[model samples]
Target chain A: MRGLFAARPLLLWPAGCALLVASVAVAITIGPAGISVGEVAAVTVSRLGGADSGLSAIREGIVWDLRLPRTLLAAVCGAGLALCGVVMQSLLRNPLADPFVLGVSSGASTGAVLVVVLGVGGGALSLSTGAFLGAACSFALVLGLGHLSGGTTDRVVLSGVATMQLFSALTSLVVMSSADPEQTRGVLFWLLGSLSGASWPDVWPCLLVLLLALPACLGRAPALDALVFGQDAAGSLGIHVARTRLALLGVTALMTAALVSVVGAIGFVGLVLPHAARAIVGPGHRRLLPVSALAGAIFLVWADTVARTVLDPQELPVGVVTSLIGVPAFVHILYRGRRTA
Target chain B: MSLRAEDVSWSVGGRMIVAGVSLEPAPGQTVGLLGPNGSGKSTLLRLLAGVRRTSSGVVRLDGAPLEEIGRKGAARRIAVVEQEATPQVDLTVGDVVRLGRIPHRRAWAPLSSADEAAVEAALGHTGLTDQAEQSWHTLSGGERQRAHIARALAQEPRELLLDEPTNHLDVRHQLELLDLITRLPVTTVIALHDLNLASMFCDHLVVLREGRVVAAGPPERVVTPRLVSEVYGVRAVVSPDGPGGRPYVRFLPPTGEAR
Candidate 1:
């Protein structure tokens, strides 16, 4: 199956894309109220500017107001996270490197946790704002440390790992000390990552960020290809290695932060999605980035749907389900890598 | 283009690596830099390629200081092929060569017809036309080196800088690559450990010992037995080869006596 996909990237991308659309449709239909697929389709069509006769108000609310936003948010966040993962893997030249692995997600989680647990601000300044601030600050610190250490590739990755560990410990402290039961549960769910409270308001910002950053990242594909050969070679090819690294790192952090702020920290989606994409499309970023984005969207839409309806009334955390699925997939990839070697 | 490095000195990690090295290569001339391991041959090449900032002195291309030209501008003038390059991702051969045209390309622009022509010509020149679509990891050592050369050739720079471009190649590919490099209409500076190959291919020779130039002239004038004995710590017989009077050195076997 892997070889078949690898041999036919053009064929596989559209297949993944079609599956993603189908998964989104299923996601919008499967929830607590259990609307029919026909009702879901009618509500979606009416919302998107068609006739509205077949859909009931309750079905519309379930499909359009709640599940639609949540499912779309899941797709956007997944795509962004996966795209960020592909770029990060190429930029760092380490297959193990991901946005979360570099500690960006942990940093955002710490910020969101502090906001929820401590009620840092009474109004307007909410957990999203806190998460964004945390993510931005940690990313800045990593870049600053990278520069201070002579701007070498090794230095940047080392700094990212160090900052990640520091923020993760801080996040744990915040979670352990929270007094309010609801606040603690909220904080914990945010850390583990869930799309439970996703709304239209939350979805727009992530969509906006993804749309803005995708073109810029795609423009960098060739330079990113040059970078895989090593920094010296990239420089010899006229790439400003330090400047490009800083720019790419900043863009990836912003996208990761935007996604995390909306949907919480979804682990392994960013880490493993790119590898799967590369396994299919090879390592060319132009192909890898887009395909990974689509695959991740499909993967997360289904994962989110499962999280919501697995127990009917009580939704499991999306992060737990992703972890459950991601670990085995990750192990499979490692095994394949070993066999190839 | 002509390249001139004057009083070039460099230090890395507080240890001086290149000291007072002055050299010049005329347009379309191939100059060979010869030294033992760690004698600053690679550092000097890096300095010329603008990959490193020299501690003191100037490296000028044509007449302008290399530092004055930005990376893209400098890359248009000089292309470098380093000794060893290990790519983390398995890029196809064509993708690797396409990178050489980056200095001429805008951030978002696709490859132009001219760029494609250059890449195609480079592949043809390096005899890698058949391997253009192959993954880099699947190539043999010689093929990889040829691919590296093809990348540099695709740059179409006025000057080419190479650090041990023939390090891992078998005899056949080594001769083919050196011959191809020699025929290019560009100034070339190649650091070579093999004196015999350097004598055969390079127009001028610059021999270094302990980061200082010990001799600089035509290969025949500079590659003498005394110089080889003093710099390389080996006794050698210098003989003429080919019609151009290239000097070939034959080293005497060690006598088991400590120097």
Candidate 2:
């Protein structure tokens, strides 16, 4: 890995691309029905204009309508969150910062919960819209607080923590006051996060947002790198530090809101995946962002698959599975960081 | 490149730190700012570097108002190495030096060949080539200071501003670092507390007392016994060094009346 990073990064790009393809194939194959590898490939090929096979319509529906969309959503959400985490960590100069650290996830959850429980504008809008709005509001609050407290790292973290707690309390209130038992279940499931409702329609928006934001994040990689040195030094380098940070936060928030609306609050993927990627590759964001994204996508897809298959006929929440895996890994990384420091 | 500050004054909280201070550093000349601790030497360096805006004066680079040039443009012209910079992450020596190229890079572009060459040159100039791959935390105090210098050097700047570059360096490394600064082909302004080192390397001297310039001239003209005694409140003997004509100051034990 060291030599791979030391040499031309163009080499690693191809390997990561190959891994992404393989991971997607594996994800599409491993599910509750236990389709054969050949059948999986045949079904996939047939769907993509290959010759017709013995696969039934049910298998086709599962592969095309359910598994494919869910896998794609996982990949896109994973990539987006990981990229968001990388940028946030660098911008804040704090290793612990993730998309949720700014209370974006809580904001998203509140929006989602309101829609699920209270109903929005007489069903005029869905939970996704509320999630976006909540995410935007929380992001704006964090930015405002950061400015108020001199835009320092401590200020950002404090604001994020405060906003997170406030929104979380509100979310809990909404969930607790629900009279219907099913409504509580819906809110609880959404909080735990899943791709169970993922469909083709949900895939396009996430794909679009991820595609647009990823390149922009990559373009600002040098500026992000400069930020690791500190704001004053970055300012001296003519980085327009505040403006760049605001723009990045806005874009990341938008991506997070979109993903959270789809999968609910999938934690740890954003917080831990970037560190894993950084440990493998160096802290250079240009390579770090994409690799982290790919790794994150691969991780979530497999985690989601395990959540589905862990107890057949009853799926666990994907967020629960990811947290179970991510927390230990995150702690291990922290331990290593402590040793190194 | 001449840096001129006119009637520059700065106050923090409610106390004035630098008041009505004016000075100039000519192109390709090395000027020393000397003062006791808390005499505003560091503040003066900060003002000259345009890191801080003065409350009531103008600082010009090459006769143009510093604000006229944008931050990045000013950065290209003036590079500052502060007294203490301890980054949290464990960046390699090469990584730290590459940061100096930030102002020159476009938003998306990778480090160009020219940029890489400049980094290499800086590392070579600072004699840190062997330590390029080493983590910054592993370096000695003097090595870390040199790494900071290499970072500033990679900017390829026109004027170098240093605030006590030798603060933590040993005597040998201090002399070596000052020697390297003196040999650079650029205007240099440094805030220093070591009178002998300043007198040895600086072409011009500006002595400060209580946020004001007490004396400004060549070392020979500025480092007199009475001048040192009066400004520093210490009895000192001053003598000509050699035919090379630099004044060398020898301190006498402070008498009770000296203060």
Candidate 3:
């Protein structure tokens, strides 16, 4: 776990960012019609200068319209999910607590689908707003269930799983009963997580959330360090246990709701990236949160690139690649926990 | 600064865990709280630390009510080490100790040189400097105890409260921990089960029985054979004193046959 530049963690922020930039530059070039990494970079730089890089307008359009926005969205989603993973793990004092695994995202999916199908607010509320409400509902349900069942880590996780199943069933019923074939297709694509139609419109809100949530999380890092020890220790250290828990819960839920609404229920980035970043930067959130965010951005940029390029003309859902990676990662964590215990 | 509890009480589920108990330790005194199992030692310590709100009565820090100062303000002056301080995370010894600086640091401010020096001094005081980078989960019970003390020490607090800190420690570590607490120029309130350790190190002793103060005074006077036998259900004779010049309790054979 201490292998990834744990000693010089300050170096990780800039290095990780540079790695993301390079990965984006390289990943944008890979697609059905072969374009080189160098050509991708040139086209991107030329567009920045407001000059057409002597390539065909079709290639330029592909670079600007299709690939760039999708890649950036992937980065944002990855960072947001991972950052929230750091928060949920610390807040719940359980590493197994991720939005997707705990079924918190299923709540958001239900909200978005409610809007997509039944039109819950009669055009007054957006899908994103509904999704946020659903996330909060799921969070409340999980906490209530956990309290009812003694609220151990195992119980909390089980409650999350239960909440997830219930919401998913309700979401499917809403979709199946109401949506037309075309809207159903889009909803299905969303459920599975496809970044097919990414644009600048999708970029700003995510950027705004990241800008707001990342610093907010950073401010709570020290309090989080005490929390992983236990509530008593945190309280002794002068943390108002109930208030701190409430604040962190609100922050993590908000960020996760926003990200899930934008990009369906993208799993694994939340679970995988935080652990990876912990190994690289050690367990303090001051370093871990930023490193996790960067690692997530780097991870998804490549995952999304692979999702698009793995099958030349046909595209795969980004969630498919992440799940393929996440299942093994989760098993490894359980194994590690057993060995340590 | 002094810590004074004025008729403090706490209850849970309508059961009185800590009944009316008032205690006042002098400035920079090492006061040991001794009690039998289920005698409210831990509860009293929590009340003193302001982590547990008292059902009735006030715990004052240097004359100001502890709760009135607020958690952040109280934490700035008081550091409490609970009995179970083992962390359930992949953290190093350094990471745990650094948390003591939380009440002191601004949320946005990074760890300063002063914070580093405090942590360094604490690790050294607890003889944990070499293990600062060691994984927390890998520590032995005694080492973990020391790490907890080191963490509390890192807070640079004026009032220190420890709940049964020596339970997991070996004899040497137990002595070392109490020795460090007595020598540190702070108002220390420690809850201990070992009467001998309490007698040898603490400036004063407060003994609790069923959530009430049964005895309170210097160790030599308060630690009587009758007191030990009555409070702990043990038949013991009070020897003259240990090498530390404090009364030692030597148990005689039980008056009743072993059932």
Candidate 4:
């Protein structure tokens, strides 16, 4: 399959797009409400721009309001996170680099906590607004600290670790000192990442951000390919290394911030999906970026479906489900890498 | 003169790595830089390649300052091949060679026929046409060096700079690689450790010590017993029987303990 796609790489894009659409449709049907793919399709078509189907209000509500938005949000979040992962890993030249691992998500969590627990915005700011600000601040701090410490790629990753720990501590301090038991539970579920409250309002903005970012990233594919051999090599190949790094890093941070603000920090989708996509389509970012996004969208749609329906009446954080799958896949990647090394 | 460096110097912190060095290699001439570990050969090559900025003085191509030429413009005219290029990501040999076309590509434009032709010619020149689809990790050290040269060749550069490209290869591979480098049409500046190989291949030679140029001339005048003893702290017998009357150096065994 890898060889076939590697030969005719353009075919993979259409296949990936179809798979994503199919995954979203299938995921919308597998909840507590006994909806089928037909019902999901009918509701989406009618609500989007077709004639109204003669279905009951409650059933249509379940298909349209309850499941469809949540499923679409999962797809967008997955695609966005995976795209960020591919860029970060290639830029940093480390297989382990991801937004969640770099503490961008933790930074977002801290910002959301401050707004919710202390009313930092004095009841005027929404949770996503607080989270975006927090995400930007933490990323800036990471970049500043990394710059101060020689600004090497390894140093940037180390700075990310330091920033992550600091923000996570601040988030814990705010939650423990101020929140009551009920609010604490809500915050905990969010930190672990949940799409349970996903709605249409959350889906479009994240989708729009992804739409804008994918093209911007694709335009820089040759630059990313130059970076595979490290910054010096990239510079020798005519890339303005610092400028390219700053531009790509800024894009990934912005997209990751927007997605985390909407759905909390979903782990492993960013970390693990890029590697899988690379294996299938090879590492040329022209091909890898879109394939990774599609694979991530499909993977998360299914992962969220299992998270919400596995125990019936009790939902697991989607992060937990992804981690359950991600850890083993991560180990397999390592094991395979060892053989190659 | 093709690629020229006029009194270029580089320093890190308070320490100078390359100081007050000037060089001008004529077009199509192969120049060898001979020096010990801390002799600044690599730094000088980097400065010439425009990968590193000189702390003082200037480096120029065709009498124009490299800074004014911009990175992409310079890359189109000059190519640098370091000792090794080890990427953590998986890349095929063809992918690695194709990286040479980066300077000529626009962001949204597809790869053109010119790009494909350059890549194929480079692979053919280096005898790597069959290995284009092979994984980079599967290549031997000599093959890797050839691939690096192939990558440089694909750049279609007028000047090529290399830093100790034969460091890890065996004797035969080392000779073959140097032979290949000298045969190229581009003006070449290569850093070398082995004096005999330097004497054999270089049209001119420059010897550096402690960030300063100690000797600069043809190999017959540059590679001498007294200079080798002074610079490398070794006793050597110099004979003029090597290829093309270039001085051949054979190190004599130590006569006493601790000099």
TM-score for all models, in order of appearance: 0.90, 0.89, 0.90, 0.96
Where does candidate 2 chain B have its weakest 10-residue lDDT segment? B237-246
Model 4 residue pairs with clashes: none
lDDT winner between candidates 1 and 4: 4
What is candidate 3's CA lDDT for residue B162?
Answer: 91
Model 3 complex DockQ against the native:
0.64
Residue-by-residue lDDT tens digits, candidate 2, B1-259:
4778998999988788998999888889999999889999988887887777788898998888878876778888788887777765567898889989988988677899999999999999999999998877788999988998899899998888998999978899999999999999989999999888889999999999888899999988898888887778888888888237788888999666727
Worst 10 residues of 1 chain A by lDDT: A1-10
Writing each residue's lDDT as its tens digit, candidate 1 over B1-259 gives 4789999999978888999999889899999999889899999998898888789999988789988987888888899998889787667898789888888888777689999999999999889998988878788888888888899989988899999999978888788889989998889999998998999999999998878998999999999999998889988899896347788899998777884
* Candidate ranking (DockQ, best to worst): 4, 3, 1, 2
CA displacement after TM-score superposition, residue B245 of candidate 1 (Å): 4.4
What DockQ do you compute for every candidate structure?
A: 0.58, 0.50, 0.64, 0.75
- Report residue B46 deviation for candidate 3 (angstroms): 1.4
Pitting candidate 3 against candidate 4, the one with the higher DockQ is: 4
Q: Clashes in model 1: which pairs?
A: none
Query: Per-prediction interface RMSD?
Result: 1.8, 1.8, 1.5, 1.2
Q: Per-residue lDDT of B1-259 in model 4, one digit per residue for the tens?
A: 6889999999998799999999999999999999999999988988898888899989999999999999999999898888777887878889899989999899777679999999999999999999999888889999999998998898999999988999889999999999999999999999999999999999999999989999999999999998998899999999998997878999999888775
Candidate 2: tens digits of C-alpha lDDT, residues A1-341 = 23556456887788877888778778888866766667767887887899886778998888888888888888888889898889888988887888888888899888877887888657876888888788888878887988888888879989999999999999889888873788888777877888887998899999999999998898888788777668766766667777788888888888988888778888889889988887777777777888899888888888888888888888888999999999898888878766457
Give me the overall lDDT of model 1: 0.85
